[model samples]
Target: MAKVTLPAAADTSAATVKVWDPVVRLFHWTIVTGVVLNLWVFEHGKYAHRLTGYVVVAALATRLVWGIVGTRHARFSDFFPTPRRVITHVYALWRGEDARQLGHSALGALMMLALMAVLTGLGLTGWMMGLDAFWGVKWVEDLHGLLANSVMALAILHVAAAVIESVRHGENLPWAMITGRKRALGAHDADIAD
Candidate 1:
């Protein structure tokens, strides 16, 4: 997770602090790469593509650990959204009035959960295909395809939301994830008072 600090205030200033950590940023991008590789593998039926799935599984495991032991902003607790909050936020979004959050928004949190589920399902199904009993099983193949499609759809939605939020907040959030240094909102470096 990104570090927070309180810098001395400049002349008449107010700012929000940075929130994303390098590991979080890395996990985000690596997942994207893994997803793309999986898609390519599916389309081309390449053995290498199957190998990349293992990489994604590993990355997800790493991310899960980081969520527990990582920086303040990177922890799952920092952005887990409640159902009520998601409903409220969805209503606000429909009405062109949404609340700002330092971390993932309510819907984003749901999407994260969905993505995790789909990925886990895919990994498990793929692993089963390697087992003797499940070898060359049609059902496993079909299930893998279904989960892969779902994951891809969710990923598109995630990117779209990130774009919209970036526009609304005037912050290049995706880029921030890459660099690990978010511009402080004001002269006062502050921690998210979550």
Candidate 2:
């Protein structure tokens, strides 16, 4: 059997490090609120739903721009999930090893990308359904519904993963998103200097 070296576990008592920037935090919460409103609070196919969808689209657009030119950890390059990295992360998980990352971990980055893509599609399809040319079009409406469901499914998985990873790594992932900071890296943890 090949030997597998695991990354070191993080020290619980380590100093805190700033990871997420203000823009990243704001974008995350905005999307969460938009999703909640669209899924439950706002009436479907109504003015409020349409308005919330448009706001989500605007937030997604801003996030895309931020991913290109935002702070160190917000830039996509800081945590792009390559195939090899994803596989390595999965393997590490299977082996019960910690791979502490200062920015998004490989699987987290993949989930982030998926959520963003789904949101963009959802927004586009919703807008298309509203257009006069596509008004009352069954396919457009169906696509919109499908995208919405997909986002919900992905969101549930995202939350579960965050909870699992938080327990595994002894860090509050959701709270980190809120406060824009995480426990500082330890000697055994992977160094992700952004």
- The prediction achieving the highest lDDT against the true structure is 2
lDDT of each: 0.77, 0.88
lDDT of 2: 0.88
User: Where in model 2 is the C-alpha error above 4 Å?
Assistant: 1-12, 192-194
Give TM per candidate: 0.81, 0.89
Best by TM-score: 2
Candidate 1 whole-model C-alpha lDDT, 0 to 1: 0.77
Per-candidate alpha-carbon RMSD to the true structure:
7.4, 8.6
Model 1 per-residue lDDT tens digits across residues 112-149: 87898899899889888889999999999999889988
